[model samples]
Target chain A: MKSADKHRKIIRAATKVFAKKGFFNARISDIAKEAKVADGTIYLYFKNKFDILISVFEQEIGKLIENILLLLENETDPSAQLEIFIQRHLEEMKKNRNLAEVIHIELRQTNKLIRDYRKNKFSEYLDIIAKIILQGQNEGKFRQDINPDIAKLMLFGTLDEISRLWGPGSEEKVTVEDISRQITAIFKHGMLH
Target chain B: MKSADKHRKIIRAATKVFAKKGFFNARISDIAKEAKVADGTIYLYFKNKFDILISVFEQEIGKLIENILLLLENETDPSAQLEIFIQRHLEEMKKNRNLAEVIHIELRQTNKLIRDYRKNKFSEYLDIIAKIILQGQNEGKFRQDINPDIAKLMLFGTLDEISRLWGPGSEEKVTVEDISRQITAIFKHGMLH
Candidate 1:
């Protein structure tokens, strides 16, 4: 495999180990096993476990943002862009329960340093969602006076809570498509008139 | 302190430790030290670590339910009852952030047996919120077609997400009461006309 592919393999492994065993409890050995890389091979690519975590965060969420941003560019309709973001977000989450759990649930367990890094990286993530809302508001699709910051929390928090409710593995009672649709409806129409 | 008061102290201490460290990482020694109780003394009142979690859940949530149920008997007006439920639920969550974190975040980490116990105990918790919604629907204050199950999830999920975001220990930007009031206003007036 190419160097980039090897890097991705390491990250995929680290995410699972960190998620299943937690960041503190997860060992480099466990990550190595999950990735199928030699224990020492991990050292060749990253400085430490935290580095792997940062890599995973940047790689996973970065790729996601990049793809969505590309999608936004091609999709001129604001509603269409928003739907695609929601739909794709749910599908990605469904594909990787461990990654989703680690990001939303376990990652918060760490102290200040990791959290600060997350907040910094999360700006782009936040900005993308804010951009969608801004596009909607500007185009008269979504309501004005909706603070993108608070709205992001509601939007993000709703999805996170719903995903958690579905637990470690979601059954078909609520599909990613189902969540995508319901959240889109809520974003558009809200809970009531 | 009286034995009853001492028991309450231990319960609060356990909640704090469990919330901060989570169930798997939190040790009985830490909880006992925080509670100012002997390790063996814990066994006098409860069976084990699992017992402490269940006890904390019962004592805190059970008392809150009793208070709410008693309060509801005097509140015949559906709207007033709804307001009170929201206010008190917010207040309860604020006063018991540790307990909230433990139950909301940690309890889900348990195995099937404990999850079963939690499911049974959780219904009682849900009943408080569900009963109010049912009353509102019957009184023509809320939409009759809204599924009570879905309504509870929406309301509780919204409130829980808000609490975690506006959590007391959170570096998050808002106050619980601010989010609570804003959410309640949104719930009532909604995002659109």
Candidate 2:
């Protein structure tokens, strides 16, 4: 197999292991076994388990960011853009449940290295929401008084909290479309009558 | 010291230890040392570390619920209720940074026991938000179309995400009042002009 293919295989296996056993409990051997590779071979591609976790974020979130930017490139209406962003986010989480689980639970690690990486990469992902709000304000579609920073946290936090219900063992009955619509409605038009 | 006082002291010590070392790394001795009690005494009031964690949630969140209910007893306005909720949440998190750290990071543990406890106790905490939305709807202050479940998640998630910035090592510059006002404005008036 090509080195690139081997690298991808290891990452996919690591995602599963990390999702099931968590970051601290997961071992490199488990990842290698899942990937059907030798323990030493796993070391060839990544420095350690933390490095693999970092790569998972780098590769997955990098793809997500690129894909989202591409998806939003032609959309001019900020409202439509926000809706698309929400739809895409929910769709991705549903489609990649394991990845979603890892990101949701593991990313909260208190280690400085993980925290620093989250601040950089995760902030970039969150900045997408702020940018959308800024666009809305520039177009006069949103309130001028809205603070993008706080609004970004609200939107992301709402989405993050909502997604937690979709995790394993959760018996959520709401459809993704229903949730997307509810969130969009609330954010686009305040709850106040 | 009295039994109740000793129980309270051990819990306080456990909160500090868990916040510092995390759930998986913290030992009973660490908690005992912090509380200035014998390790055997911990087992007397609690079955194990997990019990202490659950008690932490029960005690802290229970107090939060009672305090908020008391504060809102005299206020008739739903909007004011929400503002008060936001304000109180930020204040509690700020005042109890150790508990905040433990809840923000530790509560995500994948243990079934913790997860079950979270679903029960944490759901009650979140239900407070849903009740506020339902009250607003009944009073004709909020749009009737809003789903209380989704809105509850949004409000709690927003507060949860925002509070994460207040943890140790975070250089967040926004004040609690500023955040409370911003969140209240967005939820009340939304982003739309």
Candidate 3:
């Protein structure tokens, strides 16, 4: 296989290992066995376990943001764009529980450096939400007085917390599409009359 | 000091130690030393390190909930009650940065048993928010169609996320009161016009 495919394979295997055993407990050999690759082959594509974990976050979230940007491009209404963005996010997580678990649980490292990296990746996500909120404000859809930073936190935090209920090891029975609808409604219509 | 005071002293010391050195790296002897007590004295007030951590959570959060319950007793408006609740929550965190850091950063242990305990304690918090939401719905202040559980998550998660930006190690310039006001406004009017 090409090096690109090997890289993807290693990342996929690492996600499972980290999600199952957590970032600290997961061994590089466990990931190698899961990936059906040699231990040295794993090193060829990644620096260390931390590098692999960071790559998992960077790659998965990068794809999510890219997908949201693509979906937002053809949509004229910022509100509708926000809705699609949320819907696609839930759908993606629903489709990939391993990825969701790794993103939610395993990424929470105790190290300050890892935490800083996670924060940077999270800021990228917030930036995407900020842009959508800004567009909505400019278009007179969202409230003009709302600060984009605060608004983005509200939007992102809500989705993230709800996602926790449906990720791997969760017992919540709510369907992703249904929850997404409920969320969009909350965002579109204020909780008060 | 009395045994009760000793219990409180140990918790306070552990909070500081845990905040500085983290949960895993912290030693029971360190807590005892900081509290100015013998190592065996800690076992009298607590079972072990985990118990000390849990007690810190239980005592602090239990007090917070009790205070909110007391304050909510006199407030007729559920919305105002929520505003007060959010404000108090932020104020308490602002007042105690050591506890805040330990709760936010150090308490995130990957152990399943610890996660279970955290969830149970968190459920108590969720219950408080749910009651407020339900009360608002009954009073026709909040939308009756809103799911109290989801709404609670949104409120709690939003505050929790924004709190991270202002916690002990955070560099964000936003004040606790100002951010609390912004959060309350979002909970009330939301992002939409």
Candidate 4:
């Protein structure tokens, strides 16, 4: 396989390994075994275990950021754009449960070094929610006094909390639709009547 | 120290060890050393490693439930009750940061055994948020159509997400006031205005 294809292929394998063994327990050998690549081949595209983790996150969340940007670019209305963003996020998690588990549960295990590498590398993805909140405010669709940063946390926090609410047996308790609706409400309307 | 004092001391030590090293990484000897109790003294109160782990969780979250129940008895207004509950919850976590970390981050490493154990044991604390929503709906303060279980998750998950959001360097990004206010809006009136 070409380097790019080989890189994607390795990341796919690494994601599974990280999800299964967690970031702490997962070793590069397990990743190579799962990826069907030589151990050295893994090193060709990445530096180490943390690299594999970061590669996976950058790929998944990068795709999400790119798609959301494309959506916001095409859709001018702030409210519609915000709703679509959250719906897409929930659906994305649904499709990539392993990535969801890794992001939700595992990435947390990484120390300052791993997390800082991520903060710098993925600042764009991190700002997507902040950008949307800004868009809403600019369009006069959201409150003006709200700080974009806290607003960003609120947006992502609501979606994240909703995703988390769908725990092990959450399939039976609630559908993703239910969560999306609540996200729309809390995001648009400030909580009080 | 008396037996009760000794038991509390052991539980406190277990909380720190489990929080720092995680359940799998932490050993009884480490906890015993921290508690100033010999390893054998631990076996006297608890059966084994698993029992100690369970005891640690129970002692920590059990007090949380007790505090919640006590609040319910004294606080009548649903919204007021929620505000105070949030404040107390933050205070409680501040007091037991290690225990909070263990519950939020570490205990999730176990298999079905600990998961089932927690679900059975802390169902009341788990249900407190649901009860708040139900009370709000009955009082006509919250949306009449809200699902209490999902609502419960949204309430707890949002708070939990924000707490985690304050990870290492998220100090200035948000505050407890923002968390409490946003959660109140999301829970009481919901996302949609």
Best by DockQ: 2
Best by lDDT: 2
**Candidate 2 at residue A94, lDDT?**
78
**lDDT per residue as tens, model 2, A23-99:** 87888899999999999998889988789999987788888888898999989999999998998888788778777
Candidate with more favorable, higher DockQ: 2 or 4: 2
Specify the highest-TM-score model's number: 2
Worst 10 residues of 3 chain B by lDDT: B104-113
- State the lDDT of candidate 4 residue by residue for B1-193, as single tens digits: 3488888899889888887777766888999999998999998888888888888888888888887789778988777777777766665665566766676666554423476786776556758877876787788876665667765655565555556554445554445676667656545543332
Interface RMSD of each: 3.5, 1.1, 1.9, 3.4
> Cα lDDT of all candidates, in order?
0.70, 0.85, 0.78, 0.70
Better of 1 and 3 by TM-score: 3
Mind giving the per-residue lDDT tens digits that candidate 3 earns over A2-65?
A: 5798899999898888877777678889999999998999888888777998898888888888
Report DockQ per prediction, comma-separated. Answer: 0.29, 0.79, 0.57, 0.35
lDDT of 4 by residue, A1-193 (tens): 4578889889999888776667767788888888898888888899887778888988877777787777778887778877888888887777677777677655555534455776764556658777777877777766666666655655565565566544455545556677787667655653343
Each candidate: fraction of true contacts kept? 0.17, 0.87, 0.56, 0.30
> Candidate 2 residues B111-183, lDDT tens each?
4447878878788888888898899999998999898988998998898788877887878888999899888
* RMSD (Å) per prediction: 3.9, 2.0, 2.8, 3.4
- TM-score of chain B, candidate 4? 0.85
Off by over 4 Å in 3: A37-41, B27-33, B36-46, B106-108
Clash-forming residue pairs, model 1 = none
Which stretches of candidate 4 lie above 4 Å from their native place?
A27-29, A38-46, A111-113, A121-123, A165-174, A190-193, B1-4, B21-32, B37-52, B107-113, B165-170, B173-178, B189-193
Chain A TM-score, prediction 4 = 0.87
